[model samples]
Target: MSSTHHVTTESKPVRLLLIAVAAFILSLFLLLPLIAVFAEALRRGWELFLASLKEEEAWSAVKLTLMAAGLSVPLNTLFGLSAAWLVTKFRFRGRAFLLSLIDLPFAVSPVIAGMVWVLLFGAHGWFGPWLAEHDIRIIFALPGIVIATVFVTFPFVARELIPLMESQGADQEEAAVTLGAGGWRIFRSVTLPSIKWGLMYGVLLCNARAMGEFGAVSVVSGHIRGETNTLPLHIEVLYNEYQFSAAFACATILALLALVTLGIKSLVEHLSGHTSNSRH
Candidate 1:
């Protein structure tokens, strides 16, 4: 029995080593290109890199990207939370269909999603006549950019909250009701705390998507420099114009934003997990 146990224990280390090696190889495949971009940007010299920041068009792109993301992310978060609540907390006909539709953007190509929006809001499309009558343009404008982003990011919060809320169960709310707590009071006291971390995670994911969204935004934004162009579009414009260093500079900034958002999210999750364990 002792000899068999020793053999089993020794096999565990080899298995762990294999897993570690596989993970390292996968990480390298993902991280090497990002490392190359930063290296190239710095090689272009600090002066050229600083000049990229000073470029008026690059600044405009940054501003526009932030504006669109800011507008879209909050709106989507609210919508996602509401949709998640409705689908998970209530029993209704067609609920599954609604849930499935939330993930439609993931399946559809972003380019096709852009085309759908264009067809609906373009000069000769369904709502076009009414919008035209009111002289409201959506395509090739900021509104169109926000709309596309919202469509693509609609599922993030809902997806995050569903499993969390489901696992949390309704026992706490029932207990609150038994104690005569109002609906709002129970939710604020119980439900909100339980899901806050998951909600933050969703918000971070949504922000990442909104900030880095390229395909759908590109179709509707018209690539209007210093006006409607977003960061990703700006990077594409710079690359196409043979301004490689500047493109990398802009890309690096966006990448850093994503990394920061992810770090905050991970911290929130860790804290939430600790709190959950303590409560248990």
Candidate 2:
């Protein structure tokens, strides 16, 4: 018989000490910046903080940010669901290639992504003449912002879903089909419940990125105040104008969004774990 030795309590204390040191360092880097954002935001007292958000331009940025995220998230959710379903439920040629292509957004530079759209829509661009002739405008417009947001946040849901659903296998889906279940029926009754957590997680990340997308949206937005400016670009304008209080106030909203995302993520994780336990 092989013998196993227990780990010593002496080494346990050392491990705990090392963990404490790492935690301290991590908190300094991550937590400190978060704290700084809040501190700077509130430096001018509550009155200015409230006033900053009340500005018409600030309101416009908030609306645009929400609009972009609202549009982008749903489209990505559908795309992710479809991509995941196909990749996981069927064996097809070029499957790996398709999956790789899905991840291209992550590999590409945001600036380049925005520029690509520009080259397709700019005044002298490929489709520019035709679009202009047809009295259509896309470049330097809300549509351009929406498309750029969609491009940048595209992979979030699919990346989350593909692995989760793949591990689930096609067994249940095949069984559903064997029992004469339709495509929509199988997806609704079976696949939806299984992948809900991962889907939510993906949507969360997608929304976060959609709201905070700077580089790509910047190139397309044209920085029009109370018009094309999203929250991040608005923040940039505030900082440029030496409106530190206003800039920090906008930053604070995003910081709150980040916190909300974290809270929802934790709840989903807890619920997902509870579900697995119940099934077991």
Query: Model 2: per-residue lDDT, tens digit, 88-171?
Result: 899899999999999999999999989998999988999999999998888788999999999999999999999999899999
Q: Taking the tens digit of each residue's C-alpha lDDT, what string does model 1 give over 31-103?
A: 7878987887777798998899789999999999999989999998899878877777778899989989989
Model 1 lDDT, full chain set: 0.89
Off by over 4 Å in 2: 1-10
Sliding window of 10 residues with minimal summed lDDT for model 1? 2-11
How do the predictions measure up, each by TM-score? 0.93, 0.95
Clashes of each: 0, 0
lDDT of each: 0.89, 0.92
Clashing pairs in 1: none
Q: Using alpha carbons, what is the TM-score of model 1?
A: 0.93
Candidate 2: the clashing residue pairs are none
